[model samples]
Target: MSEDRISRDTEVLVVGLGRFGSALAATLERLGREVLAVETDEYLVQQWSHRLPVIEADATNPEALEQLGAEDFQVAVVGVGTSLEASVLITANLVDLEVPQIWAKAVSAEHGRILRRIGAHHVVYPEYDAGARVAHMVSGRMLDYIEMEDGFTIVKMRPPRETHGFTLGESKIREKYGVAVIGVKPPGEPFEYATDSTHIGADDLLIVSGDTNLLEAFAHRP
Candidate 1:
């Protein structure tokens, strides 16, 4: 799904309260969004009932989803990945209900393809994504890495010495490195949006964005 699919005012319907589902629901709620979670396991329902709005029901059953008003939500997440059959069924039911944005978790490439063919608006491989992000972080100076669509990435990293004490325009970071410094966060101060006049400190953290390879090269600078 596109980034605009879920906004600050969106209420989410989360199916399958497993690890991925629970974390998604909890984080959404913590961020001040309303969430309704559905789980097949009674124990899981009971465990999270005190913390979130959860119900004990099988999401594979379209009737159950309808009874729980699944069709009423614009955004629905299928977090059942352990069993391929159950995951497919739940995603299909959401599709039948015509949910505007459906995000499904897939364990493998085949599973993701099936989910997309069956109308899942977005398919995420959490394990693979996390592994890739961690690999990038460990291999360079990046403290955080987010790979977006079409090989674009945004990273939080320390500024290289070549950029220290120079303004954005003076350093010509975009021209030389093929990347842009979006913002700078000096120690003990809030992050400020970068401009041509912005000066970077040696210890300041940078919010950089560009193509994945170019960002890697920029972040790897000594």
Candidate 2:
């Protein structure tokens, strides 16, 4: 709904008209993007038909996707998270079609593993991201968290008061918190990932990566 949302008519194929997929399609449509919503459930297809161009077809079928002109689309989003079988199949089909950008919604680590193996360009866990953001808000440490793998995460946070004037090596975060300061974004400056000797400042945003437990522990430390 924001006026800043770009209105480009880029072609995007959407598989599975579930809650996530439907929401994605509607948002993209509002942004003036061409969305082709595909669903295996006839009931869901009918429900969203009024607001979207619905196709009641199984995305597991490679031929169905081909007929739907999925390969022609610049991007594809597979949002069947409930059923791992369906999600994996649809992701594989998209890969086979050579979709340039394939983003799949994964419910679990195992599900993400299979999706990536089959060639999902990006795997997202909506629930996990929301939970992490909420957790950070309560602790007042991280601005955001991005999961890189099952156990590892990247955390964005302002430099702690204790680390206000210390250089990266002086802080000894790798030894104390078991995290690596990968990048720093100072106020009004572009992010720098190669800053090892740069001193931490009150306004500098630190990007660090470590296990979730380690990151959370560091975030809550006094």
Q: What is the TM-score of each candidate against the true structure?
A: 0.92, 0.62
How many pairs of residues collide in model 2? 0
lDDT of 1 at 155: 98
Predicted structure with the largest lDDT when compared to the true one: 1
lDDT of each: 0.94, 0.84
TM-score of model number 1: 0.92
Tens digit per residue, CA lDDT, model 2, 41-102: 88998899999898888889899888988888778899899988889989998888887788
- In model 1, state the lDDT of residue 110: 100
Name the candidate that leads on TM-score: 1
Model 2 residue runs over 4 Å out of place are: 1-8, 141-222
**lDDT per residue, candidate 1, 1-222, as tens digits?**
455755667789999888899999999999999999999898999999999999899989999999999998989999999999999999999999999899999999999999999999999999999999999999999999999889999999999998899999999999999999999999999999999999999999999999999999999999
